[model samples]
Target: MAILKLSAAERRRISAFFTCLVLALVAWVITVLSSSYNYTVKEIITFKNAPLKRAFHSLQSDTVNITVKGTGWQMLLSKIREANHQIKIDLSPLDYEDFVVVSSQLPAINAEKAIHNQIIAITPDTLYFDFTNRSVRRVPVRLIKSIKYMPQFTQSGLSIIKPAYVTISGPSNLIDKIDVWHTDSLVLKNINEDVTTALNLRVPAEGNISVYPKTVQVTIPVEEYTEKTLELPVKLIGNVDYYNVKLFPQKVKVTFTTSLNRYADIDEELFEAQADLNLWRTYGISTLPVKVVRMPAFCKLVSVEPGNVDFIVKR
Candidate 1:
């Protein structure tokens, strides 16, 4: 094929013609998008202002289509946000009536709408509910955590949560099954010292359940650990027959790591090592596994010098 080349002056004219075409196309889009248009969006319903005396559950699908008039730009953004947003419906009227009008809450819904958009109608404009005995219960907050501690450091005690219990109010059938409310995951990395933070309560997927005080304060006690070793006398356990038995090694060394604050106080008295005699009585084994039955909650057991003890039973 032969190559075709253009002069500088011809190239300039060609580029300007193409640029004008692009400009005209862009101008058309701006005008079209600026025009008012009506669009429909499906928004999940979030019930608020629930009735105090009655427990209610939505009888119909939780989703509703909202018809709104807005500029094309607003309609475009609303479509992008449809899956991420919800409309709040007041259920306070459910105290006396079984239904709520969605249009009645338009003022509240309009406040949360995107700029330059107006909601005209909500499909299934009336919300219906089924009633049951209302219930309010207090349940403990279970902390969900993802924590990594620095080497030689660990939690000293149970994490403390302010307002350890959250009040759950809903239909008895629903809240009754919930024993403990879990918090959103609290993540900490390479933590060497005590941590104090707040955690949000995980939202219940059920629309009827409500939790007051959305967040709880959490304090996890962390401290650097120090190793301690002690020789503890082994006591024979599971000796129901009280057979005359003796362990070859009556004592075993216990190695554990404890917080510096408790290292000085954690002694042999705080720990008890026992050898299970059930192995000798039931299975007729000569060796019993040595286990520490009691230890301070803050200590992490490392190892026992003699993991098993040899026992002899005499008639």
Candidate 2:
């Protein structure tokens, strides 16, 4: 096998040709970077150092459309670092009922260098904002939670929320109408054990209002329950008129299930079983359905014996 090697003169010529190509590429890049170009960019506008006693009720815009002119390199760098750009407007000098027309106050580049870019135009050359007197109010926080317990277990008491109330500050017109703030919805299924968790409070969609302490702790108590039986007397409802009505088996067996702590509080008086006589008189029926009128809230009514009772009327 034979290897071909370049002679000294051929090597020098090849090297010169490559060097010229490299120089030409560098010159082209420098020319492109030095040329000026115009760019349109969007920047967020924020309020800073606002007065403690004043609130902004409305703002015409939260962003500005800016057209800038700079060297191509500067524009490229600006686009890459645009995320750090923000135009802050100070509101400390404003008073209630005062309106401010805001203009662009361009930010420095790279935290040290003054931006060489000229702001050709700002779409909203002037921005407007309305100010109002700030008002503070204490509003109750309502927890929004849905819980389902496992069979044989139930909620023993009222669900509690820590920091039941929150403070809200905003324009008087907006704060005066807000009476309650609600937490985000929390759902727990097959929850046999007590639940304690932190939940975020819902923020009003309106930009004029702000709520303090954006979260609250919620606790739902759960307990094991036992079944109980009670014998409750049945009563007649509606007037019997001239007829004397008598129902067979005037008492019913009421079976219910309640939490162990509330088992002792269960009594026959907390339940009412009644038969309506108006239906008997209206339809001349000898048998009437017995209905349980009232029951304890914490107890689940399991069964009522003899759903229908025979009745006899005598004039």
Stretches > 4 Å off in candidate 1: 1-39, 70-86, 105-117, 237-245, 312-315
- In terms of TM-score, how similar is model 1 to the real structure? 0.80
Segments in model 2 whose C-alpha atoms lie over 4 Å from true places: 1-40, 48-55, 66-88, 101-125, 131-137, 169-177, 226-229, 240-243, 264-269, 278-289
Q: Encode model 1's per-residue lDDT on 52-141: one tens digit a residue.
A: 888777889988888999888888787665556687777778878989988998888889765548889999988888888889999999
Please provide TM-scores, in order, for all candidate models, with all chains considered together.
0.80, 0.70
- Model 1 whole-model lDDT (C-alpha atoms): 0.87
Please write out the lDDT profile of model 2 over residues 1-315, one tens digit for every residue: 999899999999999999999999999999998999998888776666566677775456677777878888888899675555666655544654364444434442123224667766666765556766789999999988878889888787788988999999888988998899999999889988888999999977766677889999999888999999998888998755857878888888888889898888888879999999898779877788888899987888888888888888777
Give the per-residue Cα lDDT of candidate 1 at 246.
84
What is the clash count of model 2?
0
